[model samples]
Target: SRVSLVVVLCLFAFCSAEYFEEEEEFYPPSRFPIDPDANRTMCEIIQAKGYPCEEHYATTPDGYILGMFRMPQPNNVGPPVLLQHGLLDSSFTWVLNYPEQSFPYILHDLGYDVWLGNNRGNTYSKNHTTLSIHSKEFWQFSWDQMAEFDFPTQIQYALSKNAMYPKLVYIGHSEGTTQAFAGLSLNSSIADMLYGYVGLGPVISVTHMSNLWLRDLLELGVEWIWNVLGIYQFLPTPVELHSEFVWACAECPICCNEVIELICGRHHGAFNNSRMNVMSGHEPGGTSTQNIHHWAQMVKNPTFQKMDFGAKRNEEIYGQTTPPVYNLNNLPKSLPMMLYSGSHDELADPDDVQTLVTTLEGIVESVYWKEVRKYAHLDFAWALDAVDEIYIEVTDIMRDWVEGI
Candidate 1:
């Protein structure tokens, strides 16, 4: 009887396998292959691509551990160049793809010590000395903390590590530029320590930003609503969600682009949709909801200003009825700066960029309003035509500056 039971169980198992195989034919699982390599550290990813690299870490003033990856020059001859990525973005932005299109790879090939920074709260720099990610203290930070504590700490670490150079060159994109402006504006010494700055889709003034819905959300005290809802970190990419999203985007492109366009503005043909599928896993990597609140506060306020804590708290923290504005006029007049802005950029609207240019007339070395039509905010970093439309010109400028130095 026991032998007969064993034989029956084995037959049932075989039949189940066969039945599932037949079912699989009728409803095939979606298999949009994602680039798992994106999960690697900046250094690990670079080394895997057969490049020379090193990882560096710095503890910020408030105890956040920031990460930076460096591509060393063989001779160690030129001034170091530091590249800072935008909000919810990691250092990988500098080397997101092939050497032909990557900013860090191009700079390394040009013989400069290239360093890419991962801002506080990003995947690479999430660890802190005293706080856990689950704690409210961890999410308590905003761009204010980044400007006051994170950026300066990274700059100090980079300069100290690369003591061979008297000063370093800083390149920032989007919120990278925003935090840099805040840091350098507050601390003159930090601004003076840089030989120059290059802002790629820089976000200095968002008074003319085109995202009305986002502006309305911020203006309507959405931060308080989110706080009540217990949502601190915004748009954190989970593994399962990322996989599902990759499939959705790949299988339903038209539908996906409509949603993406609503958030990041028009991409048209400028963006490589295939690359976006890969990038989606990494980008909007993660950021504090407070940071979004900071941007919203900026939108509601006429001047480029600090974070708002409402009337009573604003008076207590800032010693005034209103939040004090960051004085853009105080930026070092002699520091060389090259800025690039796209015509169709919705987040960093062209008109707002022009306002920034006018604000820093003497300091701006050059302003490139890209001629390529339909170029939007994300295009500077993610567009398929980035190499021809932006990187070539950027390389030329960097070459000239490096040679002159």
Candidate 2:
């Protein structure tokens, strides 16, 4: 079936590597921005927002040292909440918005300490214990490694520091959600360490997405070739150039909006036109080529499973002919989890979200689902009315959970 799908795709769209090469060249090398926040840290961004912030680091078992921003109130309270950004995103997404609208700030103001975790290879957490960030070994990872290493390390680190709260609530968006679900499923014991889990734009299997170019790019295995060519990093464009494109010159009204619609389906009134420039300042923060390749696997394959390391390596690593599916059945039965999906989200299609929910049926306890009719992939984090349409309901749900109601 996959073979036929690829065949059919080749007939409809140009499968020439030359075409993709001409369209999306390897990002030219980057120069640090001359802007004010060029060297800004996550804590610095949090502090700039007038929130009491602290930067913390935790070293994963694989030697990647992850960084997180902690916003604690003077009167620190129980049930700290950890927010993780999606692929090519950092903690900046939570703090980039207005204080009243920002999720992390809102939570901090609500008497809850908020922690934002950055996955390895992102802008914030690029340091490794030994390997260079440019090493092919450093790039030899996907979200599969993340679920196994990043989440557990960060959670344990947070728990150790905030001993006041025995457990903290976990929230993840997009790829963050993928790893959280995948990690927790494989090692359900991690669930015992959390107050609850929340997924904003949760994604697992994405074969049903409206966009097939991403699936096309991935199915062609373009990323593996880049790796072999020694291009370890996967910045789509440099932040410097990104800022120029968004800030100085662009189409009057629908410039950035058009591009976003091209990637994520057109969901009008979700993104603020004025703030697009500001959001671009810190966005497309970071990720690995392998991570994108891994994501493309999800986009093409229906099975919610581990990385497809080809048949030979799959046999060597998994002792199987194919990659094993992450049994959602293995998720702890009592783990309280909330999932928010958007109807217009082409990337996290409603059908796929339903499939995830269906797979977890009779397996987990206290699962809550919310579907926003007009929201798209980015809207979960970027929508102007998010506070009223999404965050308030989320906080209310979290409030009830905190009160053990």
Kindly list the per-residue Cα lDDT of model 2 for residues 1-405, writing each as its tens digit: 355444433322221121222244344433322333333556676676677888888999989989888887665655688999887778887865668777887787777878899999887888899999757787788899889999899989888877577888899988889999999988999988887899988888888887666766775777656656666656533443543454431223366555445545566435556555555556556677778778888776788888898999999999997998998888889888899999988888999999888766668878888898888887777777888888888888888767432
Please identify model 1 stretches exceeding 4 Å from their true place: 1-32, 36-39, 75-77, 240-242, 246-259, 362-373, 403-405
Residue pairs with backbone overlap in model 1: none
Which candidate has the top score in TM-score?
2
**For residues 1-405, what per-residue lDDT tens digits would candidate 1 score against the true structure?**
244323422322332121122222332355655455545656677887777898888999788999888888776666788888887677866665667677777777777788888788876787899998777688887888888898788777888877577677888888888888888788867866787788878787777888665576564565676577566776555444445555565565566666455556676435545555556555555678788778877776667788878789889989997778888767776677788887888888888887787777754444444434677877777666787877778777766655433
Per-prediction TM-score to the true structure, in the order listed: 0.85, 0.86
Per-residue lDDT, model 2, residue 3, is: 52
RMSD to true structure for each model, in Å: 11.0, 6.3
- For candidate 2, give the lDDT of residue 180: 95
Full-model lDDT, candidate 1: 0.71
Number of clashing residue pairs, candidate 2: 0
Task: Output the TM-score of candidate 2.
Answer: 0.86
Cα deviation in Å at residue 308, candidate 1?
1.2
Worst 10 residues of 2 by lDDT: 12-21
